[model samples]
Target: MSEIIRRDPRREWIARNRLHPDHASVLAALGVNRGGAAVSEWLGPHGVVRKNPHAIGFIGPNDVKRIDRSGFQQGGQSAATTPVAQDSRRTVTIDQPAFLVAVVPDLTGGRLSAHDKDLLGLARRVADADADQPGAVVAILFGEHKGEGDGELKEQALGDAGIDRVVHLNDEFYAGFAPEARLAALSAVEREMMPRFWLLPDSPLGGADLGRRLALRLGERAATGVWQVEADNEASLGWRCTARGGAGSLDIQRPLPRVALALAECAEPVDETRHAAEQLTLAASIPTTLSRIEDLGQVAVDPAGVALAEAEFILSGGNGVKEWGAFHHAAKVLGATEGASRVAVDDGFMARDRQVGATGTWVTARVYMAVGISGAIQHLQGIQRCDKVVAINLDPGCDIIKRADLAVIGDSTQILAALVTMVEQQRGGQRDAA
Candidate 1:
């Protein structure tokens, strides 16, 4: 990413599609009013922008200029910083020196006047960004409910990493799901779930729009597809968003809480066991609500539980790694877990959970092998912590290459065949020695 793009990649963004989940929802989450109703509910058989008066920005701070004035991680870039959300914002004291948003009542009806009063109030708080850890990593667990473990790993990973706090919303009041459809259905179940963040985990098309509506409704600045998780000496948090390398990366030092999406880079899930029942047991986070709509029947999900997180090494397909059966061979070779991507799932490669990205899983492990993925920003965001990353791509310029320690320019179909044999040979040798 050029330095210029890293700082200001949104020009192409502003000029493009509102249907984009990342950009649209992120800005929406940040308090920009895109102005409209849900596209799916509004658009007719033809695709067209529907202007709806309900379209509004999030609950800006009681002041506007102050927020714009106090900007970025260091609070300098005031050129354009948006508002945060009313998605049940919270301010808690966790013994760490950190800025606090004390949860004020957003009286603005979840709308912001472009550059208004409540906004400036938020800006004034920008200086409070770095309350404790200079480079603290903040993680939020969304789409949660009580009695079930939907946001389990998210909570565990952050905890295992020793991140300050794992925030969970009191309920799914602010879930990215079609709220109008099943508000009551989820509300009862989410009561026990602690959701530090309210998110829309819907499809990419609806995601951006959902975030936008959320920002407008909540009045916060929201950015989606966050690739980097770093803690600098700023307030709130600073995430390496996909916007990095394109537009300058975001330094959300603004008082407005930024809405961010973690890259679910089909990396391995972590296997940190939280001792329960005085015994070591496999820990899993599954959202279970007694009130699920029985009339609708079973919700499709990944029933197979594999030890991807436990693997010392993982070899799998990204958007690439085509030719169906090759996936099975790769997994069998290393006694590894197998999974696919959103594209892979769409093309009948694997189930949904097997798919990875901001909408999927985040993994940190020893070895990462990529075949066929173009290395889009979203795919590579969650993978920085890998001890070693090997990229195999036909396109040499894929973004994944920059992040990879080793690069292999080749086709994964053939590569997988060779790798399977190679891995088996090495494993066989290790076992023989043992």
Candidate 2:
């Protein structure tokens, strides 16, 4: 008999740490909008037709049943393995209102039990979709069993939906520790579970940290910028991501349950399925220490009113702008926000959010006219989403022309002056007519 491994990396992770599912929080580390949504388009094999569920997080310790060892503490005066709540660590009733469709690995009396009360509705929604079939079930997978029979009951939930099977794994599930070692196990579980859907978080909790860790756990490609998950079609289970910081939309595919992490970007997380019982389960398994109390209570900062989302026309000043006042002048002329070349920002003429480069935001405004901007690939990747781009530069050999929707061949400073004067003249004529 294979006894469960308590020291498993995944088990250790499940016991400690939590996944951040917001995207905005992830972007904040690099300085982005507090509420702004930066999208990462495609990183995996683009145009590759997939056949698996497309969901992120419909599962957690909450989706299971466990012992109520709530008072247990690390190195406390209490016994090391003391069970406080007499009712804790009891046999879970799958048919009961409390444990329907939840995952409890400790059902047989040894492991973790998690109850995701919040996901009750979501689980029922998924289960109901496949409930018509008795034996067929959606696979609810986890990296470890913390004595909650949640995994076991999830495997038996036939009435709730299809049969719910849980793969009680004890491996590299914890995100903080080394996670590269369990990719194979994750892949193997996913293959067997064959989930029809995948649900994920829509916050700043960047999944990349988990994905990179997951890539180590599962030997497969991991793409970032995922928001929504659909479980209907097996061939089309993936995410609907906004590429280039809301520049455009990207459809990404990842392994079902194989892609688990937090969304730190403040992006709205959506769930098509969760049942009442699921919510009850969350109530049972959720640790009190895992609330958002530690976060900055309520400090809001209004970003520079210049918004890329609503801007119909945009003007960018690059290093070629030469001076800070000149860069300000160009931005003022267009009545647009000031963007910068990476060099200009580093030189202190502009701020980072205004910087354009590969690691920056992607732009796709109607008209994006650049002045004194040398389009480098890093910069190009950001603005490549622009609908129509016009690059004004003295150097015709610049790469902007190759990728721009329209390239203007001239000195940025000279061309800008002429264009502004022409606009002013036109405006004056209109004023005279009035």
Candidate 3:
């Protein structure tokens, strides 16, 4: 005869309600909230959980187990459940100083931003040179939630990129680009880690805004769009950046514990994948006053219309394009973000945000189509990272033509019109065939 089995009341209740029996019943039994401090306590000292008074729970070691679909054992001892040694626990203090800390904003699509990767590489180099002991490279990822699937991939990627520790502030408010919420979270981490140097990417929206705000709040000097950062001695750091539209370069020196904003394409990413970094989660209380600006929704744009620094393909214009409307149409047809030289912005043909040059936004597109741009030195600096440059200019001797991978000597208006027609006809043909 088969042995009789008794059903667990909590498990039965969870089943009747169509809930996950193991996960729900275990949490209910332990009186633990999904991502709350109670869960951390139940998991023991190895698990670090921050209490966010305003927002929901955060990403932590427990999240990794949950993502792996590995049910919790009654008395099973694993990394998630193992308690830290008393001696080791004493050494890991909240206020200990780290060599460098890189604040990485959670990017969309659960991938690390190119600029953030570069910042990490820079941090690794700085830490190696400037530290008294073997310094640590820490990365703080502020986002809404631990991404889907086993959160191992992201953690591993950061480790491979040379991050010794990753502090994730996973809250719904952090999921989107909430500057105020991120600032609060970062402030909390800063207080806890007390890092000597802070690195931030100089992206238009997130990094620059956060870096400036943090500097103002903390009363630290901030250097924006910095190309190089090096320790002047052990106490001061030096920053190098372009000044006056590539006409000159400025080098500024500031004391330690300063915030530095890294410019795009300043450093190459290092390829050193190591074991996954140690992970921590911070729970923070976002001020209601600060979070008054709620994000409504996002509007859809063509996939190619990404940020200038992040775009793979770009259609840029100069004064040579007679009609701005035709130029825009050509960009739309090519599925490219519209960019402009300084002269075009000066002529009011393009907005300041669309301008690409040394003084404006620096772009590293895979294919850059420059229509009628004469290509000044400043303009050339912006597209230096572009893989292929296609220039259409009436003058064969123009600076842009000389530098272009493929140069077409023609009228800008005629070339743009022809390209638009060609793209539209191709689309029409594909539709008919379909």
Best by TM-score: 3
Model 3 ranges off by over 4 Å: 1-100, 105-109, 130-132, 144-151, 234-257, 273-275, 283-290, 300-434
* Candidate 3: tens digits of C-alpha lDDT, residues 240-326: 333122323655444434677777665677574352467865555534336777887777678444788878789999988898888
> Which portions of model 1 show Cα errors greater than 4 Å?
1-304, 307-312, 428-434
The Cα local distance difference test for each model comes to: 0.44, 0.44, 0.68
Error of 1 at 192 (Å): 51
Question: Candidate 2, TM-score vs. the true structure?
Answer: 0.31
Whose lDDT is greatest here? 3
TM-scores vs. true structure, each candidate? 0.30, 0.31, 0.46
Scored against the true structure, residue 110 in model 1 reaches a CA lDDT of 24
* Candidate structures ordered by lDDT, highest first: 3, 2, 1
Per-model clash counts, in order, read 73, 108, 2
Clashes of 3: 2
Q: Once model 2 is optimally superposed onto the true structure by TM-score, how far is the C-alpha of residue 213 displaced, in angstroms?
A: 45
